[model samples]
Target: MTTRDTVHELLRRIGESDPEGVAELFAEQSDWRFSWPDEGHPSVPWIRPRASRADVAEHFGALGAHHAPERNRTTVTRILVDGDDAVVLGTIAQTVKINDVSYTSPFALHLTVEGGLITRYHIYEDSLTVARALSGDTGPDRRVP
Candidate 1:
């Protein structure tokens, strides 16, 4: 599949909350990083580097496990594709299961597809807002409004 096709499929699978299906579009050995300086952040299950397709699957699985699919909302504002590189800009809203506090954070997900599979998956998002919500902080500023 083309890079754009692969990315669109990935988004479709993610919308369905199908973890394994999402991983199927990735290379066996992939470069994955979710938000740099991962430390000092609430240990949200999906907030770590993933090296393999299995790890990628696990990340999405953990996401589905921790947040209800009906409650977790991700809105894709734009998807820019250039050859094998695609950058998805969006906002994500989820309520942490443990604390039940909701948060909204704008995000940028960069993906590189080669050989019909995604080789790089990198994400940038507002960690502070997520961390605050995970800790049950209900401050008005936490929602990024």
Candidate 2:
């Protein structure tokens, strides 16, 4: 498969709750990094880290364990590929459980694929919205319920 195709498929596996497949889509020595816009909110800040394959596995595993009640719905907005590298821009909509409350965060993903596998992935989302929803404080415009 083309690099773009491979990357999107890997992400699709994550959305589908197929962590095994997601792991298989990466090269054994792949350098994977996931980042998000970090501003404030120390308690629940955006995530950004470079990880090994095992580290990535643990990362997603923790998320799955935490957000067990929420099913992810991801949609690809754009995909860019150059040689062995590719980037995917997409939205992730999901309801997460926090203190028995369900919260949704509309988010985006910036992925880098290399050697027909994912190398790096960054996240972009409405952090304020996520914080408000998680805190049960109702966002400015978007109501949390």
Candidate 3:
């Protein structure tokens, strides 16, 4: 498949929350880097330089455990592809219940795929917003944690 086709398929699979399909798009020993800036949340800076298939599985599974993937709607705004690289800009509206309080966070992801596999994933969102949501803070969501 062409690079654009591959990336489009991969992004579609992810938005569909089909972990199995997403995993199938990656190489067995592909190097994956996912970064979530110091959002003050424990899950921040989750860098995986060389994430294997097992690691990918665990990552998606953990996401499902934390907040049902089906509940987080992924809407793609744009996707640009060139050769073996591509960038996907999308938004995720998630409803997460933390400490009995429901937290809804809107976030964006910029993904880069190489050799028909995802190589990097960078998150763009309001850090304080995420921190407050994760910590169940209600004070104007000012502090990071």
Highest TM-score against the true fold, candidate:
1
| Cα lDDT computed for each candidate against the true fold | 0.83, 0.60, 0.58
**Model 3 clash pairs?**
none
| TM-score of every candidate relative to the true structure | 0.89, 0.68, 0.69
Which 10 consecutive positions of candidate 3 have the poorest summed lDDT? 38-47
Top of the candidates by lDDT? 1
Question: What is the TM-score of candidate 2?
Answer: 0.68
**Model 1: how large is the Cα RMSD against the reference?**
2.0
What's the ranking of the predictions by lDDT, best on top?
1, 2, 3
On TM-score, the stronger of 1 and 2 is 1
Residue by residue across 1-145, what tens digits does model 2's lDDT show? 7876887687677877676777777666555433334344443432445366765666666566546435555567777777776656655555555544455555555566666777666666666655564566654776753
Q: How far is candidate 2 from the true structure (C-alpha RMSD, Å)?
A: 3.7
Once model 1 is optimally superposed onto the true structure by TM-score, how far is the C-alpha of residue 32 displaced, in angstroms? 1.1
Clashes of 3: 0
Question: Please, what are the lDDT tens digits per residue for candidate 3 over residues 1-145?
Answer: 7767877787677667676777787777665543444233574222233367666666665555555555665567777766666666655555444443334444555555666666655556555555555556756635332
lDDT of 1 by residue, 40-107 (tens): 45556567767999998898898877776778778999999999999999999887777676678899
